[model samples]
Target: MLRFLNCRCLLLAGLLLLAPTVQAARTILIFGDSLSAGYGIRQDAAWPALLAKRLHEKSLDYNVVNASISGETTSGGRARIDAALSRYSPQVVVLALGANDGLRGLPLAQLRDNLTAIVASAQSRKARVLLVGQRVPPNYGAYAIGFHDVFGAVARARKAALVDFLLDGVATQPKLFQADNLHPTAEAQPLLLDNVWRGLAPLLE
Candidate 1:
């Protein structure tokens, strides 16, 4: 009986010692703008939230941190990147900005510079990156084309993952958007998750 009790105590101690390792899941930071921040939709209905559920369903050990802010531009993201990096220390960073920059018709060079800086910062920390792309209306003509290409240019130069456009399918459909015609409705969140997953999945391993 004494021997059995000692064995049981040792087993319990072993589990206690291993508990933190089992729970210390790596972090995935969704660093983006209004789209990722769930603008005009319930926080739970956002794609980032769905990502957490999907990770759990797949039994992937990762904790997600949605550190996005609505109206975030590449410049704004650059300003905050260091603080965010120091705070989360994420293993993966879903870098989604420049939409607001495109919308505002900011200089394409400005967009490219800020994006390069943001990706470089994350890479410096050894964090994998999924750089989400954005585009302005065709009415902007050459400027819009330049804006769209900047995301890819930065991604290639930095060797980060790229999602060509976050709202690729949803953007074409009027019904998928909110009243403001900028944000996607709650129903479109899953589709957004699907698009992001393509780029994100590759970096998970």
Candidate 2:
């Protein structure tokens, strides 16, 4: 009986030792706009989901919680950031907003401040941030330059990682985008994931 009791205790100890590893999947919260939300594609086909798949392929213990909305703006993301950080307590926060603000011709100053706040909020929670930049059509005029510059400025000032531009190569290719020519299509998801992973992979380590 004593031998059986010892065996049971050993089993319990082993299980207890493994519990934290099982429950401690590091989370990466992707807070963005339609681009990350899958817009015209299936949710599972989105770059965020692809990121999860890549993580599993490499045996990384991480979870990606995509909190993106189709029309979300920098201000909107800033407003909800604290609640998201509190809820997920993510190890990394991917800030991919501000596109809507640019599209709507919102004030660039407001966009910059909102992004700064979002980055600060995530960092305050001990979460590493990746700020994904956006670019507007040339028709929007010189305002586009300032809009594009905000991501780098915020990243540098706040000491955050940056993807530079989420749509980089894909943006110039008309075939890669949806009919609206704004959001990326399923075919472009992999490239988008690659662009983000270039910056995000380091944070995971």
Tens digit of per-residue lDDT, candidate 1, span 27-105: 8888877778777677778898899888877878887888877666788789989898898788999998887787677
Predicted structure 1: lDDT: 0.79
Per-residue lDDT tens digits for candidate 2, residues 1-205, read 0000000111110000111235546888889877777776777788888988888788888878888776777887889889988988989998988878887789989999999999999999999999988887777779988888988999999999988888878877878876665567899999999999999999997
96: Cα error in model 2, Å: 0.3
- In order, what is each prediction's RMSD in angstroms? 15.4, 15.2
**Residue pairs in steric clash, candidate 1?**
none
In model 2, pairs of residues that clash are: none
Candidate lDDT values, in order: 0.79, 0.78
